[model samples]
Target chain A: MTEKSAQRRPGGRTARNRENVLRATAEVLLHEGYEHLTVARVAAAAQVAETTVYRRWPSKAHLAADALSELARTDNPIPDTGTLEGDLRALLGQILALIERPEVRRVILTVVSLATDDDEVVAAKVAFWESRFVGAAAIVIRAVERGELAPESDPYELIEDLVAPTYFRLLVTGRPLDDRLVDRSVELALSRQGICAAPVPGRPASPSADD
Target chain B: MTEKSAQRRPGGRTARNRENVLRATAEVLLHEGYEHLTVARVAAAAQVAETTVYRRWPSKAHLAADALSELARTDNPIPDTGTLEGDLRALLGQILALIERPEVRRVILTVVSLATDDDEVVAAKVAFWESRFVGAAAIVIRAVERGELAPESDPYELIEDLVAPTYFRLLVTGRPLDDRLVDRSVELALSRQGICAAPVPGRPASPSADD
Candidate 1:
């Protein structure tokens, strides 16, 4: 049976070909924003037929999204440091490093802005986040269980507060994201009892006590 | 000469004309996103000649920034309710109202995104913030005086934390900038210090200590 048709192919040639195409797509995204990214260019760079490229991904935007999604997943490793502040520092630090790569930040900003107007791009972004959110949430939930965060707080918003400032300044204000800022953000959020410090609802202890 | 030449002739008419043009520009911005805005459109809406608009503001981006600067100046009111919590509530509440106005929010995002590429736009944004930051700082300083915040803390970053999340979510996530979210933001910031009743640094007292 052809590798492409097989439901469970023991992959060698087909999978390597796919990886090469994705790597080429990522290179294009790094060099050009989403608008200029072309499937033909990717096909040429990947040494594959345009038909083969089209058979796997119908659009350049989808190809670019997939490439970036793959990069984001692998490059930024989420650390489970057993504390909310430590975890945020680790995760946001990775994000900062990712942004530090020139043109990557611009590409991500362009992708996000385009996503605002395109449903397919938005779905791609959501899918990317969906792949990571569960892992990120595990870190937060562990922090809560360990009394590093206030038990009553919503982990999502708490994470948002810690990292959103950096993203806002980086993407909107054209500012560089840095580690000092990340540490400050973690301190600021954790000090508020909203991360791992919020007391569990209906299980509040003495005023100075933890849940 | 005419009023135009009179303003150009080093007199008060320049300020009045600028104000009138700025007001008209703000009206347009409040109605349309920055992408859809134009200098000619602003001039028509302001009842000013196209040359007159060009004579002062060089481009649509400049006109939009100037309009926002004027708006920021006019609404520089942050209520001093003698508590950090109340102060933040009022301060954030004002921002919430502004973001809820779709036209203003759209213009803000457009201009902010443009700032990434345009030096002139970035300068205009910086200048606008220079004026507004003073007002925002005044509120934070007052909170320090009233024993509502950490006396030695950096007011700028604190304000950044308080405001960045909502703007981030609004512009990036396209979420509804609702009051509940605003309230939670204020609460999170305040819970860190005695925005409600923490005494000054040298003095010792936690008003909520009884709880």
Candidate 2:
């Protein structure tokens, strides 16, 4: 339980403590929000000393950022559906589900607001987004390997295009997300890469045909 | 000067006081940020009584929302270029310029954070977005009328696709915005509506050709 020993060890009891701390952090953020989240409170909830939490995360922003990033990592797994369209649809669905939660939305908006003033939060935000993009890029890479997408296609841009609208609805316009928007977002993203999803068996080939 | 008289007068001095109050609100928000913005500060800055500001805006959140919304109104105008492509490009350019300002970004994030809990701020935010969409819809309506886009093209959807990536970069990813993103966004949006911008006289036809 010594501070020096804890810092030196990254496995066994130390690893358990880290997991417990992160879990407590998420619980505090989700239930109590960013304003109520503090190193002291998290340590108390995690059954760790204040020094332990401070030795690990320097500030409340860092703690919150890590908690949210860990939430994203664990909550949403990359889809490996056979086709790019199916995979993208599934991935978008996962994102939609995660962001739609009231607590998650509150945490996200608070993080965004904190990032405006805190450089530590900004760095954490950038790292969190970079990791998400890296994970999502697997879908595009698989599509290219299967000859379903151009090899030169930028996975980052494609992923951004696919998810931006949903996030836009969540954060910007306050518009509701729906099945139609999700389907269209997938279609538009694929079309940008010159890969169109085949029309559903009985549906019109061209969107305009419906008119 | 009397409270009753000010409420009764909608023109002349009342209008001037309204303009001055809004201008002072913008100044306080831009220079001092949302945390430092207060009715008293704004009233003192505008050379009006605090009652004047409180009579119009009941809360700090409402004052901030209205000031930011008014700023958006005066800063970005609707584009009326002859073609959808031209108009979208112009409109996006205007949007990019406005949002790129640090102060504007700060105000937007602050307002978004406030809207999570405050109903008045939420109403103002919704109204602000609706008006912007209404103004931007002119581009889509014009294009549909001129046979450049399909008759059934939804202006809101098209506009959402066109601008979501830029806002995503600003709010989520913390990525830098550039010309390539702007151009690609415009192209992707139009292509979804079955409208493609013509290649420049000497440029390649297909985007892949550039590779």
Off by over 4 Å in 1: A1-14, A38-62, A80-84, A115-117, A141-147, A150-154, A174-179, A194-201, A206-211, B1-12, B27-60, B73-77, B80-82, B115-117, B173-180, B194-211
TM-score of chain A of each: 0.76, 0.82
Tens digits of per-residue lDDT for model 2 on A1-211?
6977857468987788888998999998898788888888889989999998888887777777777777888898889998999999999999889877888888888776675566877877887788788988899889977878765567788888799998888788888889987899898888776632223333344333222
- Model 1 chain B lowest lDDT segment of ten: B202-211
| Best of the candidates, TM-score | 2
Q: Per-prediction TM-score, please?
A: 0.77, 0.83
lDDT of 1 by residue, B1-211 (tens): 5765676565675666677788888877777566667888777877778898888777776777778877866664756777666777778888788766656656665665563667777767766666666677777788778665667866667677778788767655544577556665675566545343232344222212222
**Weakest 10 consecutive residues, lDDT, candidate 2 chain A?**
A195-204
lDDT of 1 by residue, A55-156 (tens): 877676668767877787789877887677778888888888888887887786676566355676666666555656656777777886786654445556
Per-candidate clashes come to 8, 0
Per lDDT, the best of the predicted structures is: 2
Which residue pairs overlap in candidate 2's backbone?
none
TM-score of 1: 0.77
